[model samples]
Target: MENTVDQNGLDEAIIVALGCNLSGAYTSREALLEAALEAFSSEGLAVVARSSWWTSAAWPDPAGPAYLNGVAVVQTSLDPAGTLAALHRIEARFGRARGELNASRTLDLDLIAHGRRVISDVVMAPHPRAHERLFVMGPLAEIAPDWRHPVSGETAAYLATAASIGRDARP
Candidate 1:
């Protein structure tokens, strides 16, 4: 989240999913992640907690480089939109390109949740596709085992092991 806020906005906790397969302007995946965290911190988004990194096959079971994935919990005074904007900004700073769906990327930053707020604006919290991917659920479970999906009401732990593995697994 950014440091700005709405008149009615209060401090909120947010979950962010980070992943990288390709190296950006940064030298490597770790550097890209470090840069992203630095950017978040610069924006006043405090990283309260983060999951251990997990390696996973690229989506669609591609033969490309495996991606590093993790989850983070952040605290910020910024409203939902501001937080989302900050995330996009961070992604852009790392040279993320948007075009084809499911394309390989240098940095993928997804806002998984923003407190208990349910929003359906341009950015969707508690990402609709998050629960569908073991790569996401696996890391999310490591950091937020007790976290419940705002939409499906399933815990991250449950979703991580749901249907064993694979992106097509049911939660």
Candidate 2:
């Protein structure tokens, strides 16, 4: 469905995602962002804001190249489940492989938050640990600092601050 926005603000919530690990190739951050924008656009999603790519060293197994991560805000009508499904499809289209947890992937689309709805069942809303991950919060804060977690009652800035503390310590 086509999204609607009033003079006050957007009428629909925005779904955000990050595209990382580009097909085991040396893909630049801009390419990843472009692919994400194209994928979401094809699904009739509107991008309201996006952040520059932030490169980070590999983690855990460190089996692949460093990842270039970033965030994108898109307006959508799909519910959380539907949205996640769409994101998974997009990742598949980009050659994403679902292996071990934290394994290398072609794309990583995380739904940071959806308006004020706090859903937590099969698909948790606001990403259960979004606030605790610097890669997610750092980019999210750039676009939606004032956006608060419906359940935690904490702003993106607060979450980002808390997330930054142990980011470097991640192993």
Q: Which candidate has the top score in lDDT?
A: 1
Cα-based TM-score, every candidate: 0.84, 0.81
CA lDDT of every candidate: 0.75, 0.66
User: Runs in model 1 with CA error above 4 Å?
Assistant: 1-12, 163-171
lDDT of 1 by residue, 1-171 (tens): 332222132224478889888877778887788778867888779887776667777777568677878777888898878888898888888889999887889889898888767789777876877887787887777666777787788877898877344554221
lDDT of 2 by residue, 49-108 (tens): 776666665564456666667667777778778878888888777777888887767788
**Which portions of model 2 miss their true places by more than 4 Å?**
1-12, 23-29, 61-64, 164-171
